[model samples]
Each structure stands twice: as C-alpha cells, then as structure tokens.
Target: MPSFDIVSEITMHEVRNAVENANRVLSTRYDFRGWKPL
Candidate 1:
C-alpha cells in the first residue's frame, strides 16, 4: 500500500517563484511599456 500527504508550503513556494518569473518577463518586454496601472 502507498500513502501520500500534501503540505502546501512547497506548493506555495513554487507558485511564488512562477509569479516572480512571469513578472520579470512582463516587465522587461517592450510591448508592456507604457501600460498604466488602473
């Protein structure tokens, strides 16, 4: 038999990293320039 357990700390860490990478890409892209926050 096998058992599994999920601890959200690891999941959250990965999510945070993904968001950071996405933000970095969006900020550096030329098309994103002049986009104002609402």
Candidate 2:
C-alpha cells in the first residue's frame, strides 16, 4: 500500500495579469484581431 498527499494552487492575480497582458497584445496586434482565449 502507498499513500501520499497531493496539493495544487493557483495565483489568480498573476493569471489575471497574464490574461490582461495577452488581451492587450491581441487587441493591439493586427494579426490577432477577433481572436479570444478560451
């Protein structure tokens, strides 16, 4: 038998920051116009 602890975490602030940056880039870039991340 084996037992272990699994833990996971997400930093929402960083995630939001990244998404905002990406969105800004996508919006400004001509090639990425109308593209959105799922």
Candidate 3:
C-alpha cells in the first residue's frame, strides 16, 4: 500500500472563475441548454 498527496495550488478566485466559466458555457451552449446536471 502507498499514500500520497495532491496539490493544485489553485486560488479561490481562480476556482470561482473556472466554475463560473463552466456554468456559463453549459447554460449557453445550445446542445447543453436543456440538459440538467445530475
């Protein structure tokens, strides 16, 4: 067995921006406009 740690060094602002961008794309993309997130 082994143990490990992962770090991205991503800031809160970066995370928020990424999420917002993804949501914006998902909501506006015609193919995904009617799709519902699970």
- Candidate number achieving the greatest TM-score relative to the actual structure: 3
The per-model lDDT (C-alpha) reads 0.82, 0.88, 0.91
> Candidate 2, residues 1-38: lDDT per residue as tens digits?
99999998889998999989988888999998888667
Candidate 1: worst 10 consecutive residues by lDDT? Answer: 6-15
lDDT of model 1 at residue 25? Answer: 86
Candidate 2 clash figure, as a count = 0
Could you tell me which residue pairs clash in candidate 2? none
lDDT of 3 by residue, 1-38 (tens): 99999976979999999999999989999888788888
- Candidate 1 lDDT (Cα, whole model)? 0.82
- List residue ranges in candidate 3 displaced over 4 A: 1-8
Poorly placed runs, candidate 2 (over 4 Å): 1-9, 36-38
lDDT, residue 19, model 2: 88
Model 3 lDDT vs. the true structure?
Answer: 0.91
Residue 4 of model 2, lDDT score: 100
TM-score of each: 0.61, 0.56, 0.63
Which sections of candidate 1 miss by over 4 Å?
1-10, 36-38
Error of 2 at 16 (Å): 0.3
Which of the two candidates, 2 or 3, achieves a greater lDDT against the reference? 3
Candidate 1 residue lDDT tens string, 1-38:
99999875558889899989987888889999777545
